[model samples]
Target chain A: MISKKKVIAVGAIALAAVLTVSGCTSRTDSSSGGSTAAAGAGDAKITVAFVPKLQGIPYFEAMNAGGKKAAEELGITWLYQGPTTADAAAQADIVRSYIQQNVSALIVAPNDPDSMAPLLKEAADKGIKVLTADTDAPDSVREVFVNQASVEGIGEALTDQLMTAMGGKGKYAIVSCGETAANLNAWIAVQKAYTASKYPDATLVNVVYAGEDQAAATSMATDLMNANPDLTGLVGECTSSAPGVAQAVKDAGKTGTVFTDGLGTPQSMAPYLKDGSSSASILWDVQNLGYLAAWAGDQLATGKTLAATNDVNADLKGIAYDSSSKVLLLGDPLVITKDNVDTFSY
Target chain B: MTLDERTKPAPQSGRPAGSSTATAKRILPLPVTGQEFVLIGVLIVLWILLGIFTPAFLTPNSIQPLLVSVAPIALIGVGMTFIIITAGIDVSVGGAIMLCAVIVAKTMVSVDIPLIGAVALAIVVGLVLGVVNGVLIAYGRVAAIIITFGTANIFQFLALRVFGSSTVNGIPSTLEVFGRGEAGRTLGVPNSFAIMIVIAAVAWWYLRHASGGRHLFAIGGNANAARLVGIKVQPRLLVAYALTGALVGLGACFILASGTATLDQSVGSGKELQVIAAVVIGGTSILGGRGSVIGTVLGAILVQTVTSGVTQLGWPSQLANLFVGIFIIIAVGTDLLRERARRKA
Candidate 1:
């Protein structure tokens, strides 16, 4: 007699086999295989790929949208791809895959810039143009960097905003996304120095690391608040920390009392803004950064001579390309408040 | 098996003779297993020490969120217990969770589906993924770890495809009942934690009393022998994986509710390892034929408590893993010492 276990097992196996076959048949006909971005083909249109630190977050997604716009305007193939997690090894694999594919140019925001330096150099040696955007790989042999404002400017503005919200004189805490994150460390260093010089009365009580988990961030934020009941401000130093800090403030019923702000996306912070749990979020125009990077990539691909003092394309008029550093600078920070949060969708 | 019995072969093997079966079959109500008691003792000591040191660690505000986080890991531990009991493992649960969570999150975004519908879809998706793992391992007769590893990649690929390059934003709060919000609680206890207890209790009963459940232990003990005794070994193996998949679906909802409205692509990263650790720490033999869902639940609780305690103590978050590694060694070491003592007795 066929046992009960056999029936369920055999039945499940049959069902799975059927699903696999069906999954193969119904696969989407996209240009890129596992990669999300596709090329809009035109004759002599060079394909340039933009690899982000990770996928499926608002920040990089906004960047990809900007790249797509640039690709459409410039008539080039925009390949946007990266690992789903912020893992350096996985990112190296993606870079290797791109190298093997031999795309015209490569733009990347490296998760581990030092480790990716050799791979970036390899791509550049093969006559494939290389550039770093959003987060620079200064050690790598990349052609240029597309920076979104100066690091000092962002840190000073972020600390200034938090200090103003705290009324310039109370204990506060800072929650960063991860300790090993390169960009966050740079910003926090500047923030600490700025705080020391500018807001003498405000004491930075805690600096906690959340490790990219929103749940953990919320817990740490709550713990920080509870441990120091007299704290006046909470600064979330990354996109994931803002909501988590806001949620903690809201959960503790200290919305109006404990002011919160961070570097976060508009969509993630809208609810917090409306509820008064957070006052403002400081971020640069990420889409503009992506656009400038893709434009620079196209310039490199078409064999156009990009001089140190050359005027940027008409579509991107205001951005300046520094010849000495090869850095294309996007403008100042865009502060998102309750009144203007609706203005920015991403 | 008796606490002191070691030389006696497993009763499921049917080679232990009649007297051995009689001795092993002595009625003992489920109050405490050896590993479980040790885990409970350790947890109590840890909690007391944390409370004495931290002062705030004993409060509800500190404890409630910790329990809320534990709910999903323990819930998935139920299925993992079954899988391990059959001498099998499913490392693709993390990938399976991502697939279920993303699909459910996307559905909540596009069409305002009811909570029940959302949950059913998650479970069904998980079951399908489970079936994939089951078929390959059982029918193809491949090692469970290797097969699940391959399927993990496929499931992750499927989940990323569903993500479509952007985070699923503005997820409706249909899953708030399982979240850390006020709505997720009943009598100051999180509903997710309560549900996990109920499920674990049911699983405990089934694993102990049901004939079908005993068949799983037989298969794990010796698949060839199980087949000779008219037990369907392949089917039992398949069921273990499918059950884990179903739990992954429900567990994903707990995960979804536990987070912000924005569901990122890193939803279920590193979860499979956590579940396996809990099961192993619960004293379940990796070689199979012995385990309890109750122990798995307690193991999950113990793990979460250590994490919460460390953070509350104002220590570096990185130090929590060092403690967890030490606990795993201690738990396994104790088990090994006990096994040796039982053999000598």
Candidate 2:
């Protein structure tokens, strides 16, 4: 008979082995090597990794859902993986992990556009079709970018909303999540330039940061509203800032007078929309972005060059790409207002 | 040494009571008390240096950020110091913060729970997570580090599932007041600073004078000895972790209330390292039995000042991290060397 200690040791070793094997298999299934191709000539099995800035965000979740839908329709394997946190290094690690898995393509929304360039270049060197969506790394080695909407268009739209809310003339403020964020800065710059050219009556009083934190956004919004009582409109450049600004307005009892708008989930902005504390909000179909990203990866894996007006025949219609730049624009932004808020679904 | 004999003192009362009392004071010299004085001196010197280097560092606008940034960390560090003093570590405090913040935000938004009620619920969640850590460490005799590390991942995963990577906004008015409201300025000083000062004072008083505090040190110094003396080691250890958890929960209230309830997976990521570094640098022995709340606060300020100063200088933000890593190494290295020297002497 075996000693009790010896028997326990053996059992522990066996359990460890089982756990190790299960973990390895699950990891493999979630990543590349899981994709299988159809028999059709152009139906090459491609594994595309759709990496968002972070996981668990509604925006990115929607984008992933859309990507999954497109992937299913196009018969491509979609690897939806990202760091739980919005750290560039974490994102880079995920990219490197996917590359090691020998993924066919990578669609990334970089947390830091410039910082991720080197890693994207490395992926490109390995023959992976690298693309960016929602956010772009212009200097990166990615072949294409599936921009949701033009930065200029977003800026112009925001400025237009601000001007309209302010009744064409008042000192307004902007609450940005990060000063260094390329997209937010781009929007701010465009809005500034547009204000200079188009809406000269509107003056931007200040642009403060909440450091991409929800509480900080709320506090900063409160500070901004309190500091600029004459401020007719507040535009939040980050998703966290919208509800924060609305809450501030509601608390201050200036809801009808001081209108707010920004990029955020309808679920988050629902109360504000209902109460007329906020005018409108804009965001892209994130799930569709993820879906398209996977579809685009499969197309590239099959060696199909993305052409202008190619109509890749996916659930999302009006798909177009610029071959020279290898950039894909994922249609237009969906604006949700009180009138059509019910129609908009995540 | 026999316990009966160790408890008995030699009956050599030749000297006068006043002289003997003075001699007794001189011999022991309050090791921990002297250490705090040195820490304060160092902090003052650093503050002066910062003021000289960056004129704006002393101003309200520049200093407010530092205070706000350090408040959450300092709040968590207070409980952490107590836990560490008991020879236990809570790597899951960051997770506790996240968990608490998520629960509070969800309760506030989804259930429309009042701010205080939501906050209470968040604290309860924190207590539960902490209790799990305590049970694993105290009852199961599992390594505190290992237990907390596992719990950290579990809490993070749970937070992700609950919040779904989205920030929760529309915090109620009362919470916003707690997070950002300034108590009326007294002599041009912000109320937040006063609050921090008061907390530091209370923590210092408790750690220095309380009997429970003395027991914590005794248990940390030697758990076997503590148990032999019937000191209830396990329960104290459990309470330490539970207190840390509650403090982390309280810290989360301030952190979440000060910001929107957006669950950034990265919100408290890698913060455990920083908190540990601050505790160690504050002259708290990682091996336990000795620490000062005052030292931890100063250490927190030093770390935040360095971070904010580096950012203000417009250096690559990574440089701040590099500096912090180096500071931890040097501080801990000096502490170890000094400790070794003391033992040798």
- For model 2, state the Cα shift of residue B330 in Å: 5.2
- Mind giving the per-residue lDDT tens digits that candidate 2 earns over B1-345? 221221122212223443657645422214344345555776678668767765455666456545665777776788889888887788888777877877777677677677668668867887888888988989998657667767887787788777765656554544654444342235544444455568767877777767677778888787789889888888888888887787677677767655543344445656677688778778787767878777787778778776666544434445666877886776666666655655665
DockQ of each: 0.23, 0.14
Q: After superposition, how far is residue B245 of candidate 2 from its true place, in Å?
A: 1.2
Candidate No. with top TM-score: 1
Best by DockQ: 1
Model 1, span A1-346: residue lDDT tens? 2443564476468557744543343222112443433232224458888888876677898999999898898778888876666767667777777776677889999988999999999999888899999888898899889889888988888888888888888888888987887788898889888888888998887788887777777878877776676878998888888887887787667887899999888888888888888889999878877888888999888887566554555645667678778887786777888899888768
TM-score of each: 0.86, 0.70
- Report the C-alpha lDDT of model 2 over A1-346, residue by residue, as the tens digit: 1432453465466456644543443345434433331122135566677878877777787787877777777767777777665777667767777777667888899998988898888888988888888888888888788878878878887878767777888777777877688888888998888988998888877777666655445545554554454778888787778777775566446778888888867776777887887888877666666666777777777788776865655556668787777778777676777777676454
- Candidate 2, chain A: TM-score? 0.85
Per-residue lDDT, model 2, residue B87, is: 73
What is the CAPRI rating of model 2's predicted complex?
incorrect
Show model 2 residue runs off by greater than 4 Å.
A1-53, A68-132, A135-144, A150-288, A291-307, A310-320, A331-346, B1-35, B38-69, B164-171, B182-203, B222-230, B261-264, B305-330
**Which pairs clash in the backbone of model 1?**
none
| lDDT score of residue B35 within candidate 2 | 41
